[model samples]
Target: MWSEIIGKFKGMPSQEKVVRLLLERGFQVDGQGHVVSGRIEIPHTQIAREVGVDRRVVDATTEMILKDDILKRVFMNIHSIASFKDVAPLLGLGVIIITPDNAQNIGILNDVTSVISMFNLSIRQAVTDDPFFTDEPKMTVITNDVIPGELVSELRKLKSVKSVTIQ
Candidate 1:
């Protein structure tokens, strides 16, 4: 699905960057070609600066997205989520980042969470990167308390997991 969406901007690198940024941050391209987070409008200049493209490029990209039925549907419905991984330490929560060998592989989350549950750790939140949106997708689990090294080792041994980082 992402491949198909990205293919639409084949010859337009700047537009591709704009689209990727929009998708990553869950910014919507409204019917009027404005970049918005929910109902709040985000200026084209700000988006362009973050993507290192001209404001005109951002405008053009949003216009193109709004023009396409599929893109318009996707952009209009996408949303952002509040992830706790970044602020876990400040909140005295344990953070575990799992890099999977294949994010598309099923059962990775269940297996990892089972291991964490076996240790009786209370999970605060669990977030997984959408495989289509990220090249190296990962799963982040926030726990109520620090995770033990033994559990980290067990998570690393999961067939689907490539690496495990605990904080």
Candidate 2:
């Protein structure tokens, strides 16, 4: 799905940078061609600076998105999410990072959570990096308390997990 979105900007790397940035940050293009995150307008200059492209490149990218029906539909509905991976430990929560053998494999989240549940630990949050955007995608699971050390061995037993680390 992401490849399809990015394929349209082939041969135009600068605009591609803009498109990647917009998708990365979940910034959407409005009908008026403004870059926004749920009603708040984002200046093209700021976007360009982030992606190391010219302001005009961001403008042109959004213009192209608005012109294409598929791109417009996608960008109009995309949104950002809040993750607790970084803040979990700071707030006395335990963090588990799992690097899967194959990110594309299904049921990894459910399987991991099931193992976590057996430990009787309550989950606070779970976030998985998009393989399309991340070079090495991993899953971050936050628990209300530190997980048992023995759980590590159990997690390693799962065929889907390549490695697991508790922080």
Candidate 3:
């Protein structure tokens, strides 16, 4: 599905970057070509500065996205999530980051979560990076209690897991 969406921006690298940034950040391109996060409007200049493109490029990208029915539908419905990985300790939560040997491999999440569950840890949140969007995709699980070393070791032993970090 992502490949198909990206295909539309083929040969247009600036537009591709804009689209990728929008998707990664869950920023929406409205029918009127405004870039927004929920009700907050994001200025084209800001998006262009972040993406290293001109403000006109951001405007054109949003215009193109709004003009396409498929892109419009996707952008309008996408949203950002609040991930707990960075502030887990501050919030008195446990965070486990798993780097998969092969992110596309099946059962990685299930296997890791099974081990976590075996330790009787209640998961507060789980966020997985989309392989298509991120170069170093990882799975972050937030638990109610600090994750034990035993659980981390078990997670590392999973067939799909390459490394595990508990914090």
Worst 10 residues of 2 by lDDT: 80-89
* Tens-digit lDDT track of model 1 for 65-133: 888999999998999889988889998899999999999898999999999999999999999998988
Q: Sort all candidates by TM-score, best to worst.
A: 3, 2, 1
RMSD vs true structure, all candidates:
1.4, 1.3, 0.8
Cα lDDT computed for each candidate against the true fold? 0.93, 0.91, 0.90
- What's the lDDT for residue 167 in model 3? 80
Q: Is candidate 1 or candidate 3 better by lDDT?
A: 1
lDDT of 2 by residue, 48-126 (tens): 9998988999889989998999999999999988888888878999999999989999999988999999999998889
Residue 120's lDDT in candidate 2: 92
| Candidate with more favorable, higher TM-score: 2 or 3 | 3
Q: Could you say which candidate leads in TM-score?
A: 3
Candidate 3: minimum summed lDDT over ten consecutive residues — where? 147-156
Mind giving the per-residue lDDT tens digits that candidate 3 earns over 24-118? Answer: 99998877899999999999999999989999999888888888889989999999998878899999899999999999998988898889999
Best by lDDT: 1
Q: Estimate each model's TM-score.
A: 0.93, 0.94, 0.97
